[model samples]
Target chain A: MFFHIILERNMQLHPRHFGARLREKLVSKLIKDVEGTCSGRHGFVVAIMGIEHVGKGLIRDGTGFVTFPVKYKCVVFRPFKGEILEAVVTMVNKMGFFAEAGPVQIFVSNHLIPDDMEFQSADTPNYTTSDGSVKIQKDTEVRLKIIGTRVDATEIFCIGTIKDDFLGVISDPSAAV
Target chain B: MSGEEEENAAELKLGEDFVKAKCLMNGEVSLILDRRLEQLQQLSEDPLNQMPQVFEKSLQYVKRFSRYNNPDAVRQVREILSRHQLAEFELVVLGNLCPETVEEAIAMVPSLKDKGRGLDDEAIEKMLTDLALIKSSSSSGHLLKKLGFGLASL
Candidate 1:
């Protein structure tokens, strides 16, 4: 879900960034520093929307660097219990396959997979049905529901299930969906 | 297994070899075996080796049983049904099939119908529901359709 909430971060600037493009440097630095990083409180920082207000830069005593408190609006992606998400398969194994919806890594345990789909050990491990159809392998796009999630300092690990109705593969990437 | 079931099991022994081969092709134990076979197939069929014919039949077996081979699914079913009083093989069947309805669950344990209010009849239903394994009969065609397995006929 996208939120227009404001977030505060302490941004430091080098002496070289004190010239005409100081604000541009600060915004670009903010995007690079925050995007893709997760917080225990919020979720994954998707994109920096706008600068709410940059606090007056405070110069350090001996280092001569300026530290400014920057407030900005950003979009964050967070997976909640029961939230359905479409993700791309990253890796497939005997346990199950791991998928990523942006920054969130979801694990759909074979237990949580529909019983008809069985795990196959091939050059590329995949889950397929008895008829050699409905194969889920690397790069396959899947729709799954988050049953359980554990958000860490930098990453979100989720236990998802595709066994439910309307949850599973969306389309094969090779088929271009 | 009951008296009649025992006789059926004995009768099944006649096709023991055929059954074992079929199981290895598409049963729970094949899940692990298939993984190894896949790796071996890839290695043996390398650019230099190019000897895939060595396990060509096995490759087809792995493909056929790929979906029915997972032991983890059985393990999960076992964990969920451990509270109930049931035999090991019965649990295996339940794990493998993962019946999606109360009617189907009962079908898996049809012997229970004769026992008159057999052990927590509602447990299986609740378990399947809670695990989100029940196929939504009402929805019909959806995910399976996108995968080329339409539900129109079913």
Candidate 2:
């Protein structure tokens, strides 16, 4: 009788033990859920939800709420001062040709065109320039090295020089192509 | 194994007694050597040999750590190590055990204060804080440390 009475008293003193155990189980499940979602992923999709100043949203991933900080990867490209880059001709004008490569676009002045090429006019195609030195057509590949950059209110102008190895027509069928 | 033990064995074999002296001063020579051995063990057990690049470079780092005095050498090694993809386990193990030689290499680089006669401390502090935040928020802290930023500050 005394042993039974003592057992009952111990159980009464620790009445919250069962609830605590249940809570622990729930927390463990939450951790696993979070870890399963966030682990081994290359990128994250963030959802912003709020009215004004009061914003409440959960970060969904393997990294739990406790580990609030997450890592992100960004690509940054820095070109050398005189390094040559291959680009595609986007537009042609009497002054020059516009070429783009990666995140930069450059204008090659008419004077910079190879000496052997001759510029011709056509109604259907608009304008054409061809020289044995450079075979340039619509969407022709050319190499240009950045000479200067100017940032203005309207647009950023990148000036480039079109002379050097791997700087000319890359799509010529007669050449290595 | 710890990083210090690996350092000793690699250093002894490479005949880099100079590094040993610096390690002694820092009281971390043993830890570094032991971690080096541990890395070797981990590499041997790795199934895909995904760690060969990391291991090879780590061995080179240990060897160079013994000889590194000038900032140029440190910068070179840091660049090489930063290119490779290292596992989290390897990173965690290696990040904790930087060699005294690397510390010396960092010291050799001219501080921002020494770059000019007068400088704004606020700008420098902001720059340092930004860099620190970037480092801490990065997934690969090991890569940052390999690039020669002291781990203590991180």
Candidate 3:
């Protein structure tokens, strides 16, 4: 889930970043520092939207680093329980399958799959139904629901299920017609 | 929606509007309920709405959900499941799946297996059958399902 939020941060500018295009320099620094970074509070900062406001520069003693309080809008991605997500199947194994929806890595345990679908080990491990109507393998796009989620400081781990109806393979790359 | 849920929806709206304007976005699935597609459709219809090329192309992704696109039917199905006091997970699964039989509903909701002491199969069958009637009416109205081998044939 992505949320558009205005978050505050204190940006420290080095002496070299002092004049013309200094604001641009500060923005570039902010993006380099903030984007792709994960926090316990805000999942992942996908991108910086726009600068809300930048406060007056506060000079630090001796260090000569100018600190500015910047408020900016950003898109934060956070996964939540019970949300249905469409993800690309990254791997398939005896235990289950691993899928990725953006930065979130989802584990769809075999126990959470529809009873008809079974894991078939081969050159490329896959899970297929008894009737052979549905097949799940690497590069397959699936619709799944998050049963559980844990957001770490660095990454998001999700427990997902495809047992529910309308929550399975959306497209099969291997079986493309 | 409750006050907190409304606030959450408002925040979600802000996120969507940002996605419409700035062209940066993406999801968790559960955070997105079954009902917001209509609102998104309305947003897409707005001449002022500026969606990125990716989002416009990906509108097909939302189209895949045409089966569960009926808000009224979904609400009714959710109500029936809640009246039965089914667990939240079971309710959501049933609402989205719209299972027509006790067996179908049971297949979608594993929670039914553990909570089966008092909840009989017949009761679930009836509720689901009723849901099916409601769902069939709505699904017939959905052009996407009718476009090819209908899910109804399954």
Candidate 4:
């Protein structure tokens, strides 16, 4: 009777041991699948999916995906040479003026300033129109050329030459009319 | 010494069997191998080997005009490097051997190839970003000329 009890106890331990081994195998497989799915290089293109605004999911492969939140922002422009661009003056200085064209920021140098205008102040240089027909003010709308570009860690600087025939202040007829 | 004595010494050193084997190797049956061996031997004797000379020439060319930092300058260098096979080889070697001189040359290769065809806006923007990384003033005119672009165009 004691020998029979010992055999029965061994049989019970066998199933428990088999179940634990199977569980461990399954867990390892799951961990491998997760890790393998996430391994990818920075430049590799990923398909984006999922519902709008909740969070965007990146489709890494057929088996797995990752998700991240998106931040909303204003429009940004990445202009190139010979591109016709419109910008509003953000700041004016003796050397040049800084303008925002969509998301891109550009500088128009003093040399590019129209020849007809004399700079009134060294600290805050104001220019008069070449024909004396218009007085250019701050926050003026202008068309520009992308002559040069410089990109830094935080910002991109585009240099425009006002010497071109097409580049200058835009006349607002609605304000006059 | 005497011609007959020299001939006898040569035969003794090489042996009759050795001469027979040499003749068999040089025979018409193996004419190609014999010719190749002769050519190699001649090259070994030549004072100025062509490959190393070509490498040295290329290095000198790169050292002379290594300014490719400016956008306009980069454009010029691209034109020059693309045109000349020797210039391209030099550019590659310069990048490998004297990295500092050839760094811009290495960066300019892709840009030159990219500009050969029309690129999308994003690609052009990326190219502009890539261009900002270089800082050299070497003339790439010779390379561009080799690529067949007109000097005026560059």
Among the numbered candidates, top DockQ falls to 3
- The TM-score, computed over Cα atoms with residue i paired to residue i, of candidate 2 is 0.30
The TM-score obtained for chain B by all candidates, in the order given, is 0.48, 0.25, 0.52, 0.22
* Ordering by lDDT: 3, 1, 4, 2
Weakest 10 consecutive residues, lDDT, candidate 2 chain B? B18-27
| Model 1: fraction of the reference interface contacts it also forms | 0.00
Runs of candidate 3 exceeding 4 Å displacement: A172-177, B1-154
Q: In order, what fnat does every candidate score?
A: 0.00, 0.00, 0.03, 0.00
Model 2, chain B only, scores a TM-score of: 0.25
Candidate 3 residue A106 C-alpha distance from true site, Å: 0.6
Task: Give the Å error, residue A34, model 3.
Answer: 1.6
Give candidate 1's TM-score: 0.48
- The reply for model 1, stretches above 4 Å from the true place, is A2-4, A14-21, A59-64, A172-177, B1-154
lDDT of 2 by residue, B1-114 (tens): 122223221112112222221112001222233454575576587522432232233233333222233334333433333333322212111222222232221221112234
Whole-model lDDT per candidate: 0.57, 0.35, 0.62, 0.36
TM-score of each: 0.48, 0.30, 0.56, 0.31
User: Model 1, range A16-98, lDDT digits (tens) per residue?
Assistant: 88988999999988966886577744666644568989899999999989999998875454455544446778999989889
Q: What C-alpha lDDT, on a 0 to 100 scale, does residue A59 get in candidate 4?
A: 41
Model 3: residue A158 alpha-carbon error in angstroms: 1.3
Residue A137 in model 2: shift from native, Å? 2.4
lDDT over C-alpha atoms for residue A173 of model 4: 28
Local error of candidate 2 at residue B68 (angstroms): 38
DockQ of 4: 0.01
